[model samples]
Target chain A: MRIVVQEAPFDFAAEAQGFSRGLSGMGAVVTFSGLVRDDDGRLAAMEIEHYPGMTEKAIRAIAEEAQARWSLGDLLVIHRHGLLAPGETIMMVATAARHRAEAFEAAEFLMDYLKSRAPFWKKELTADGAEWVAAKDEDEAALDRW
Target chain B: MDVLYFAWVRERIGLPKERVETSAATVRELVDELRAREARYEAAFADLSALRVAVDQDLADFDAPLAGVRELAFFPPMTGG
Candidate 1:
């Protein structure tokens, strides 16, 4: 299991490639990527904020929970903070397993937890002003089904 | 005590960090103490609605004691993904 919380954007291809180590048991790899959205290029960017120490702890815990929920071989989770322009990579999760079922489920679970449980917050810089994004009810309810 | 702020809570208080010395035993008490200190803290913690606290990097409640917690974090609801 691996968890990373950094301000720098991640290279998904590299992360997936690196996850492929000397293990012979793994047969499948599943991944997901989230990108910053653009509204006709009207919105400039996003200023992401997070607790310095608590962010990593929260992420690691989520990854661990995902690991338990699935028979994942190796897990890679990376989330980016700091000012990010639209089209920038926001987050990525990769799961490896001996079969597709476990890898796919675990990858989705990681994203689910990342959506609501992680300690990061985002503010969007729009033409009007800076507005802090509120926690979405849909995101919270999505977790309940899990 | 090492006090940390996260997300919009930091922006509301205009403080990202502070080191305080207090005898408050629990996170809630510390918040009460802080609210008493200044208007900014009071406003930031005014509602405590949609707020969450963490002790030593662990998700905790406002009532959880600060017995062995080295750090306390306050912030609004999370928007992680």
Candidate 2:
């Protein structure tokens, strides 16, 4: 398992390939990437803030839970912080397992937990001003399924 | 103890973190003391439901004890993914 909290943008394709390569007995791999969305085309950039000491700890706990609940070969989580333009990658999660079901389920589980549990906050910047993005009720509700 | 703020809480309070000396026994009591300090703190902590708290870097409720906690953080619900 690997967890990365960084401000520098990551090369998704390279990271994905690196995560899946040279794995023995792992028959399936699942990957998910989140991107900044400019829904109204008014978004100038997104400013991400996170608790330096707590962010890594929280994400590691979530990843460890995923590992315990699923039969897997490996998992990877990479989250970026700081300013980012629309369409840029925000984060990515990858899970490798002996079968697709476990891989996919673990990936989704990681996402759901990371959405509401992590300490990162996002602020949307536009021409008019900036507004903090609110957490959705649906996002919290999504945790109940697991 | 160290008190930290994030997102709008930091903006409203006008600082990211500060050293706090207090005899508060719980998170709620600490918040009350902070609210009494200044109007900016009052405004930042106006709605308890709109904020979340962490004790020593772990999420906790306002009613949680702060007996041995060295760090406390207040922020809005996380929007991470």
Candidate 3:
């Protein structure tokens, strides 16, 4: 398992390709990427702030939990912080397992945990002003399943 | 101990982090001390339910004891992915 918390943009295609390669024992690989949404077309940018030391620790814990719960060959988590423009990739998760079910389940589990467990905060900047994105009740409730 | 704030909490507190010397035994007591200092702290901590605390970088409750804690952080609900 690998966890990366960085500010620089990552090449999703290259990362995915690298993750898929050299996994001789794995039969399935699943990857998910989150992008900065520009729903209203008025967005100027998105700013992400995160606690330096705690972010990596929290993500590692979540990734380890996913590994423990699933029979996985490998997994990767990459989350970016700081200023990002619309259409930029914010984060990505990739999971490899012996079967498709395990790969998909682990990927979803990682996404769900990372959504709430990590210490990153997002602020949306628009033409009017910048606003901190509120945490949705639905996102918290999504953890009830596990 | 070092006290840190993030997101709206940092904005409300008007600073990112600071060194705090306190005798409080728990997170609640430390919060009380901060609240007694100024209106900004009072306003920042007005609603405990709206805030989250971390002891030494691990999420903790307000009632968690501060024994041996070198760092404490306050922030809103995390919206990360």
Candidate 4:
């Protein structure tokens, strides 16, 4: 398992390729990337704030839980912090497993947990002003499905 | 113990982190002590429903004990992805 928390943008294609390569028994690989959305072109940028020490620990615990619940061969998580413009990549998650079911389920599980459990917060910037993004009830409800 | 705040909590409290010395037995009591310090803290902690707490970097409730905890954090519900 590999987890990265960085401020610089990552090369998603390269990272995905690297994660999928050299797999011995893994037959399926699932990858997901989150991008900043500019709704109606009002969004200027997104400022992300995170707790340094706790961010890594929280993600690791979530990843460990995914490993325990699924038959994943490997997993990769990369999340970005700091100011990001619209259409920029925010984060990505990948899971490799012996079968597609386990890989897909584990990936979804990781996303659900990361959305609510991670110690990162996002503030959206627009021409008018900046405002903190509120956590949606649906996002919290999504965890119950797992 | 070190007390940390994030997001609007930090903005409202006017600092990211601070070292706090207290004899509060629970997270709720610690919050009360902080709230008694200044209006900013009181305003930031006015709505408990909108806040979340972490003790020693792990998610916990307001009733969680702070006996041996060296780190405590308070913030709004995480908006990460």
Best by DockQ: 3
User: For residue B35, what is the lDDT in candidate 2?
Assistant: 94
Candidate 4 docks at the CAPRI level of high
CAPRI quality level assigned to candidate 1 from its DockQ score = medium
lDDT (0 to 1) per candidate: 0.85, 0.97, 0.95, 0.96
Interface RMSD of each: 1.0, 0.4, 0.5, 0.5
Which residue ranges in model 1 land beyond 4 Å of their true spot?
A: A20-23
Better of 1 and 3 by TM-score: 3
Each candidate's DockQ score against the native complex?
Answer: 0.79, 0.93, 0.94, 0.94
Give the per-residue lDDT of model 4 (tens digit) for B1-81: 999999999999999999999999999998999899999999999999999999999999999998989999999999888
My TM-score estimates for the predictions, one after another, are: 0.92, 0.99, 0.98, 0.99
Q: Ranking under DockQ, best-scoring first?
A: 3, 4, 2, 1
lDDT by residue (B3-50, candidate 1, tens digit) is: 888777787789888898888998889999999999889889998767
Better of 3 and 4 by lDDT: 4
Residue A8 of model 3: what lDDT? 99
Please tell me the interface RMSD, in Å, for model 2. 0.4
Per-residue CA lDDT of model 4 for A1-146, tens digit only, reads 99999999999999999999998899999999999998889999999999998999999999999999998999999999999999999999999999999999999999999999999999999999999999999999999998
Question: In model 3, which runs have C-alpha deviations exceeding 4 angstroms?
Answer: none
lDDT of 4 at B13: 98
Task: Give the alpha carbon lDDT tens digit for every residue of A8-114 in model 2.
Answer: 99999999999999899999999999999999999999999999989999999999999999998999999999999999999999999999999999999999999
Q: Please provide, for model 1 over A39-89, each residue's C-alpha lDDT reduced to its tens digit, 9 standing for 90 to 100.
A: 667788998888776788889888888878888888888899999999999
Which of 1 and 4 is the better model by TM-score?
A: 4
Instruction: List model 3 lDDT by residue over A63-92, tens digit each.
Output: 999989998999999999999999999999
